[model samples]
Target: MTGSGTRRLGLSRVGAALARGWRAVSWYVKELVGENDYERYVTHLRRHHPETRPMSRREFERAKLDRMDTDPQARCC
Candidate 1:
Protein backbone atom coordinates (compact mmCIF):
# COMPACT_ATOMS: atom_id res chain seq x y z
CA MET A 1 0.00 0.00 0.00
CA THR A 2 2.86 2.38 0.87
CA GLY A 3 5.48 3.57 -1.64
CA SER A 4 8.42 1.74 0.04
CA GLY A 5 6.34 -1.40 0.47
CA THR A 6 5.40 -1.35 -3.21
CA ARG A 7 9.04 -0.91 -4.18
CA ARG A 8 10.07 -3.83 -1.98
CA LEU A 9 7.44 -6.07 -3.49
CA GLY A 10 8.46 -5.06 -6.99
CA LEU A 11 12.10 -5.75 -6.26
CA SER A 12 11.28 -9.15 -4.76
CA ARG A 13 9.24 -10.10 -7.82
CA VAL A 14 12.05 -9.04 -10.12
CA GLY A 15 14.56 -11.08 -8.10
CA ALA A 16 12.35 -14.18 -8.29
CA ALA A 17 11.88 -13.73 -12.01
CA LEU A 18 15.61 -13.36 -12.52
CA ALA A 19 16.27 -16.53 -10.50
CA ARG A 20 13.79 -18.49 -12.61
CA GLY A 21 15.27 -17.15 -15.84
CA TRP A 22 18.79 -18.10 -14.71
CA ARG A 23 17.69 -21.65 -13.93
CA ALA A 24 16.04 -21.99 -17.34
CA VAL A 25 19.12 -20.71 -19.10
CA SER A 26 21.40 -22.99 -17.08
CA TRP A 27 19.25 -26.03 -17.88
CA TYR A 28 19.16 -25.17 -21.58
CA VAL A 29 22.92 -24.76 -21.74
CA LYS A 30 23.52 -28.08 -19.94
CA GLU A 31 21.14 -29.89 -22.29
CA LEU A 32 22.66 -28.27 -25.34
CA VAL A 33 26.15 -29.34 -24.24
CA GLY A 34 25.14 -32.88 -23.20
CA GLU A 35 26.21 -32.10 -19.62
CA ASN A 36 23.22 -34.00 -18.29
CA ASP A 37 23.86 -37.18 -20.21
CA TYR A 38 25.45 -39.07 -17.33
CA GLU A 39 22.64 -38.19 -14.96
CA ARG A 40 20.04 -39.27 -17.50
CA TYR A 41 21.90 -42.49 -18.21
CA VAL A 42 22.08 -43.28 -14.51
CA THR A 43 18.39 -42.67 -14.10
CA HIS A 44 17.59 -44.94 -17.02
CA LEU A 45 19.84 -47.66 -15.67
CA ARG A 46 18.19 -47.48 -12.27
CA ARG A 47 14.75 -47.71 -13.82
CA HIS A 48 15.41 -50.34 -16.48
CA HIS A 49 18.42 -52.27 -15.24
CA PRO A 50 18.58 -52.04 -11.48
CA GLU A 51 21.09 -54.84 -11.29
CA THR A 52 23.67 -53.05 -13.42
CA ARG A 53 26.00 -50.26 -12.46
CA PRO A 54 26.21 -47.15 -14.56
CA MET A 55 29.46 -46.06 -16.17
CA SER A 56 31.53 -43.28 -14.68
CA ARG A 57 31.20 -39.84 -16.26
CA ARG A 58 34.68 -40.01 -17.74
CA GLU A 59 34.08 -43.49 -19.14
CA PHE A 60 30.71 -42.52 -20.54
CA GLU A 61 32.13 -39.48 -22.33
CA ARG A 62 35.02 -41.51 -23.70
CA ALA A 63 32.67 -44.22 -24.94
CA LYS A 64 30.37 -41.64 -26.47
CA LEU A 65 33.25 -40.10 -28.35
CA ASP A 66 34.40 -43.51 -29.50
CA ARG A 67 30.96 -44.37 -30.72
CA MET A 68 30.73 -41.11 -32.59
CA ASP A 69 34.07 -41.77 -34.24
CA THR A 70 33.38 -45.40 -35.17
CA ASP A 71 29.80 -44.86 -36.24
CA PRO A 72 29.23 -41.92 -38.50
CA GLN A 73 25.51 -41.99 -37.82
CA ALA A 74 26.04 -41.63 -34.08
CA ARG A 75 26.91 -37.93 -34.39
CA CYS A 76 25.71 -35.08 -36.54
CA CYS A 77 28.21 -33.89 -39.09
Candidate 2:
Protein backbone atom coordinates (compact mmCIF):
# COMPACT_ATOMS: atom_id res chain seq x y z
CA MET A 1 0.00 0.00 0.00
CA THR A 2 2.78 2.40 0.92
CA GLY A 3 4.66 1.64 -2.30
CA SER A 4 1.60 2.19 -4.45
CA GLY A 5 0.87 5.45 -2.69
CA THR A 6 4.41 6.61 -3.29
CA ARG A 7 4.11 5.70 -6.98
CA ARG A 8 0.91 7.67 -7.30
CA LEU A 9 2.54 10.67 -5.65
CA GLY A 10 5.47 10.48 -8.05
CA LEU A 11 3.10 10.23 -11.01
CA SER A 12 1.23 13.32 -9.82
CA ARG A 13 4.45 15.32 -9.66
CA VAL A 14 5.42 14.12 -13.14
CA GLY A 15 2.02 15.08 -14.47
CA ALA A 16 2.33 18.57 -13.03
CA ALA A 17 5.75 19.02 -14.60
CA LEU A 18 4.52 17.80 -17.97
CA ALA A 19 1.67 20.27 -17.76
CA ARG A 20 4.11 23.12 -17.19
CA GLY A 21 6.36 21.99 -20.05
CA TRP A 22 3.40 21.69 -22.38
CA ARG A 23 2.38 25.25 -21.48
CA ALA A 24 5.81 26.52 -22.53
CA VAL A 25 5.70 24.53 -25.76
CA SER A 26 2.27 25.87 -26.50
CA TRP A 27 3.49 29.43 -25.97
CA TYR A 28 6.43 28.81 -28.30
CA VAL A 29 4.12 27.39 -30.93
CA LYS A 30 1.91 30.45 -30.72
CA GLU A 31 4.89 32.67 -31.30
CA LEU A 32 6.30 30.62 -34.20
CA VAL A 33 3.52 28.89 -36.14
CA GLY A 34 1.00 30.22 -38.61
CA GLU A 35 -2.63 30.15 -37.55
CA ASN A 36 -3.55 27.03 -39.49
CA ASP A 37 -0.48 25.12 -38.41
CA TYR A 38 -0.96 26.17 -34.81
CA GLU A 39 -4.53 24.91 -34.85
CA ARG A 40 -3.45 21.71 -36.53
CA TYR A 41 -0.73 21.12 -33.95
CA VAL A 42 -3.11 21.72 -31.09
CA THR A 43 -5.66 19.39 -32.58
CA HIS A 44 -3.05 16.72 -33.25
CA LEU A 45 -1.84 16.78 -29.71
CA ARG A 46 -5.40 16.69 -28.42
CA ARG A 47 -6.27 13.73 -30.62
CA HIS A 48 -3.18 11.64 -30.22
CA HIS A 49 -2.08 11.15 -26.63
CA PRO A 50 -2.85 11.20 -22.95
CA GLU A 51 0.51 12.65 -21.97
CA THR A 52 0.19 15.85 -23.99
CA ARG A 53 -2.32 18.53 -23.08
CA PRO A 54 -4.29 20.60 -25.56
CA MET A 55 -3.88 24.39 -25.51
CA SER A 56 -5.83 26.74 -27.72
CA ARG A 57 -4.10 29.41 -29.76
CA ARG A 58 -6.04 32.05 -27.89
CA GLU A 59 -4.86 30.75 -24.54
CA PHE A 60 -1.30 30.60 -25.71
CA GLU A 61 -1.43 34.11 -27.06
CA ARG A 62 -2.93 35.43 -23.89
CA ALA A 63 -0.31 33.73 -21.81
CA LYS A 64 2.40 34.98 -24.12
CA LEU A 65 1.13 38.51 -23.76
CA ASP A 66 1.06 38.15 -20.00
CA ARG A 67 4.60 36.86 -19.91
CA MET A 68 5.80 39.58 -22.22
CA ASP A 69 4.30 42.23 -20.02
CA THR A 70 6.03 40.72 -17.00
CA ASP A 71 9.47 40.41 -18.61
CA PRO A 72 10.88 43.59 -20.08
CA GLN A 73 13.07 41.80 -22.64
CA ALA A 74 10.69 39.02 -23.60
CA ARG A 75 8.60 41.01 -25.99
CA CYS A 76 10.15 40.39 -29.38
CA CYS A 77 7.64 42.27 -31.44
lDDT of each: 0.94, 0.77
Model 2 scores a C-alpha lDDT of 0.77
Q: How do the predictions measure up, each by TM-score?
A: 0.91, 0.40
Cα error, candidate 1, residue 43 (Å): 0.3
Q: Write the per-residue lDDT of candidate 2 for residues 1-77, one digit (tens) a residue.
A: 49999999999999999999999988888767544555677777877875887667788767767877999796556
**lDDT (10s digit) by residue, model 1, range 10-57:** 999999999999999999999988999999999999999999989999
The candidate that wins on lDDT is 1
Error of 1 at 63 (Å): 0.7
Model 2 misplaced stretches (Cα beyond 4 Å) = 34-77
Which clashing pairs does model 1 show? Answer: none
* Residue pairs that clash (backbone atoms under 3 angstroms), model 2: none
TM-score of 2: 0.40
Superposing all C-alpha atoms, what RMSD in Å does each candidate have to the true structure?
1.1, 13.1
